[model samples]
Target: MSRIGYARVSTIDQDLETQIVKLKAEGCDIIRSEKVSGASRDGRAELATIIDFLRPGDELVVTRLDRLGRDTRDVLNLIYECEQKAAFVTVLDPHVSTRGEMGHIVLTVLGMVAQMERRFIKERQREGIEQAKRQGVYLGGKARLDHQKVKDMHEGGAGASEIARAVGCSRMQIYRILQSNR
Candidate 1:
C-alpha cells in the first residue's frame, strides 16, 4: 500500500514546509498540500482531490489531526470515507491510525477535542476584540481598496479593466465602485 500525505495551513502567510518535511520523512510516496482553513471542508480543493483519488490499500497521512479538519463532524466524515475506500488515516503527532479498533476510538476523541479547541480559540478572539473595542484600540482588518482612488481613476477616462489593473482589484469591483458613485 502506498502512503499518501496531506498538509494544510489556515492562511497564506503560514508555511507548509515543516509539515511537508515531516510527511516526506515518514516516507509518504505522494503529498498534497494547500493553504486554506481546515475549519470547514469548503474551498479545500486539494483535500477533495486526495479523497477522491484514494485507492483501496492506501494510507492517508497528515502531520496532525487538525490538518485534516478542525470540525469533529468533518474529520469523522473524512475518516469514514477513507474506511469506505479500505484506506486508513495516519496522524504523525500522537501517532494515531484507524488500522485498529482502539485507534478509531482515540481518533474520534481527538477529533472532538480539536473541534472544541477551535471553538475556544474563536471565543477568545472575540473576547479580545471586544476588550480592545472597549479600550478604543480596536481597528478592523486593513482596507485593500481605496474608494477615492477608484473614483478618481474612473473619472479620469480609465476603463473598468484598466482601473482594476491599476488599483489591483477585480473589474467587478471597479464596476461596483463606478456604479455606486453614479
Candidate 2:
C-alpha cells in the first residue's frame, strides 16, 4: 500500500514545518499541505484533493486527529469516508492508526472520549450561564437599545418604525422587546 501525508495550518503566518517533519519521518511518499482554518468549510482543499487522489490500499496520514478536523463529527466523517474508499487513516500523535481490527478498537475508544469531552464542555457552559443568571448580572448580551428608554418612547406614542429607525434595529426587535417588558 502506498502511504501519503496531509498537513494543514489555520493561516499563512502559521508554521507547517513541524507537521512536515513528522510526516516525512513517517515515510510519506508525497505530502499535501495547506494553510486554512479547521473551522472553515472551504479551508480543507488540500485534504479533499488528497482524498480524491487516493486509491484502494492507500494510506492517508496526518500529524494528529485534530489536524484532520475541527470537531469529532468532522473527524469521524473523514475517517468513515476513507474507509468507504478502501483507504486507511493513520494518526501520528497518540499512536492511533485505524487500518486494521485493533486500530478500530482504538478509534472507537477515542471517539467515545471525544464525545464525552464535548458533553462536558456543554454542561459546564450551561452551569456557567445558570450561575451568571443567579448572580443577577448580565447573563446574556446587552440590549442594543435601552429597555427603559424604548418603553418610554413607545408609551409616549413613538411609532414602531420610528423606534426601530432610531435604535438601528429592525421593527420586529423593538416590538418583541416591548412585548417582553409588558
Candidate 3:
C-alpha cells in the first residue's frame, strides 16, 4: 500500500513546508501540494490529481482535517470519494484515520467544527470591515489595474487588446474601463 500525502495553503504567501515536513515524517511515499483555498474543491488541481490517482490500497495523508477542506460537505464528499476508491484518509494533527469505523464519526464531528470555524472567521472579517467603513478607514481592495493608465491609453487611440497588453490586464478589463468611461 502506498502512503500518499497532500498539503494545501489558502494563499500564495502561506507556507506548505510544515505540512510537507510532517507528512514526510509520517512515512508518506508520495506527496502532492498546492497553494489554494480549501473552502471549496473548485481550483484545487493538486488535490483533484491525488483523488483521481488513488488506488485501492493507497492512504491519503494530510497534516490536519482542515487542510483537506474547510467546508464540511466538501470534506465529507472527499472522504466518500476516497472510500469509493477503496483508499484511506489520515489527518495527522488530530490523528484520525478512515481505516476504522470510529474514525468516520470523529471526522464528521471535526468537519462540522472546521466549517463552523470558517463561518466565524468570515463573520468576524465582515464585522471588522464594517467597523473600518464606519470609521472611514476602509479603502477597499487594491486595484489590480491602473484605471488612470487604462483611460489614458484608450484616449490616446490604443485598441482594447493593445491597451490590455500595455496595462498588464485582460482585454475584458480594458473593455470594462472603456465602457465605464463612456
Candidate 4:
C-alpha cells in the first residue's frame, strides 16, 4: 500500500513546509500539495488528482483533519470517496484514520469539531472587525493592488497585459479597475 501525502495551505502567504515535513516523517511515498483554502473542495486540483489516482490499498495522508477540509460535509465526502476507492485516510496530527468502523466514528466527530472551530474563528474575526469599525480605528485592510499605478499606466496607453505585468496582477483585475474608473 502506498502512503500518499496531501498538504494544503489556506493562502498563498502560508507556508507548506510544516505540513510537508510531518508527512515526510510519516513515511509518505508520494506527496501532493497546493496553496488553496480548505473551506471547500473548489480550486483544489491537486487534491482532486490524488483522489482520482488512488488505488485499492492506497492511503491518503494529511497533517491534520482541518488540512483535509474545514467543512464537515466536505471532509466526510472526501473520506467517503477515498473509502469508495478502496483506499483510506490517515490524519497525522490527531493520529486518526478511516481504517475501520471505529475510525469512521472518530473521524466523523473530529470533522464536526473542525467545522465548528472554523465557524467560531470566522465569528470572532467578524466581531473584531465590527468593534474596530465602531471605534473608528478600522482603516480597512491594505490594498494589495495599486489602483493609482494601474490608472497611470493605463492612461499612458499601456495595454491590459502590460499593466497586468507591471502591476503584478491579473489582466482581469486591470480590466475591472479600468472599468470602475470609467
Candidate 5:
C-alpha cells in the first residue's frame, strides 16, 4: 500500500513544509499540496484531485482531520468517498486511522463534534452581526478603494490584476466584489 499525503494552508504567507515533512516521515509516496483558505469551497481543487487518485489499498495521510476537510460534513464525505474506493485514511498527528468498525464509529463522533463546532461559530457570528446592526455599527470592513474609481478603472479596460495591484488587494478579491455587484 502506498502512503499518499495531502497538505493545505489558508494563505500564501504560510508554508506546507511542516505537513510535508511529517507526511514524508510517515512514508508518503506522493504528496498533494495547496494554499487555500478552509473557508473557501472553491479552493478544493487539490483535494478533489487527491481523492480521485486514491485507490484500493492506498492510504491517504493527513496531518490532521481538519487538514483533509473544512468541517464535519466535509470530513465524513471525504471518508465515505475513500471507503467507496476501498482506500484507507490516516491522520498522523492525531493518531487516528480508519481500519475497521470501531474506527468508523470514532470518525462519526469526530465528524459530529466538528459539525457542532462549525454551527456554534456560525451562530455566534450571526448574533454578533445582528447586534452590530442594531447598534448602528458597521458589520463589514471598509472597502479597499472607492467604488466609482474601481468602476472607472474597469471601464477604462484595466484588468483585475492591474486594478488589484493599484488597490493593494488580490485579483480574486477585486473580481469577487465586482462580480457580486452585478
Candidate 6:
C-alpha cells in the first residue's frame, strides 16, 4: 500500500515545512500540500488531487486531523470519500487509523473537537477586535490600494483597467473604488 500524505495551512503566511518534514519522515510516497483554509473543501486543489488520484490500498496521511479539516462534517465526509475508494485515512497525532472500526469513532470525536476549537478561536478574535475598536486603536486592515491615489488617477483620465493594473489589484476592486467615490 502506498503512503500518500496531505498537508494544509489556513493562510499563505503560515509555514508548511513542519508538516512536510513529518510526512517525509513517515515515508510518504507522494505528498500534496496547500496554503488554504481548511474551513471548506472548496478551492483546495492539492487536496482534491490527492483524493482523485488515490488507489485502493493507499493510505492518506496527515500530521493531525485538523490539517485535514477543521469542520467536523467536512472531515467526516473526507474520510467517507477515502473509504469509498478503498483507501485508508491516517492521522499521526493521537495516531488514529481507519484500518479498524474503533478508528472511525475516534476520528468523529476528534473532528468535532477540531471544529469546536475553530469556533472558539473566531469568537476570541471577534472579542479582541471589539476591544481594540473601543480603544480607538483599530485602524482596520492595511489598505492594499491607496484610495486617494486611485481617485487622482481616475480624475486624470485613467480608466478602470489602467488603474487596476497600476495599483496591482483586480478590475472589480477598481470598479468598487470608483463607485464609492460617486
Better of 1 and 6 by TM-score: 1
Pairs in steric clash, model 6? none
Q: How far out, in Å, is residue 46 in model 4?
A: 0.7
- Write one digit per residue (lDDT tens) for candidate 6, span 1-182: 89999999886558899999999999999999987789999888999999998889999999999999999999999999999999999999989999999999999999999999999999998999999999999988877679999999999999999998898766777899889989
Compose the digit string of candidate 4's lDDT tens values, residues 34-106: 8878999988999999999999999999999999999999999999999999999999877888887888999
lDDT of 1 at 25: 100
Candidate 3 regions with alpha-carbon error over 4 angstroms: 142-182
Q: TM-score for every candidate vs. truth?
A: 0.81, 0.59, 0.80, 0.83, 0.72, 0.80
For candidate 1, the lDDT comes to 0.93
* Candidates' C-alpha lDDT: 0.93, 0.80, 0.92, 0.92, 0.81, 0.93
Error of 2 at 171 (Å): 37
- Per-residue lDDT of model 5, residues 1-182, tens digit only: 78899998876668899999999998899999988866534667888887888889899899976677557767887888998999988877658888878877877787677567767888998999889999999559655466676667998999999998887666787887788767
* Positional deviation of residue 158's Cα in model 6 after best superposition, in angstroms: 16
- In terms of TM-score, which candidate is stronger, 2 or 6? 6
**Positional deviation of 64 in candidate 6, in angstroms?**
0.6
lDDT of 4 at 119: 97
Quality of model 4 by C-alpha lDDT = 0.92
Q: Give the CA lDDT, 0 to 100, for residue 80 in model 5.
A: 88
The residue-by-residue lDDT of candidate 3 on 21-135, one tens digit each, is 9999999999999877899998788999999999998999999999999999999999999999999999998999999999999999999999999999999999999999999
Clashes of 6: 0
Q: How many pairs of residues in model 4 come into backbone collision?
A: 0
Off by over 4 Å in 4: 145-182
- Give the best candidate by TM-score: 4
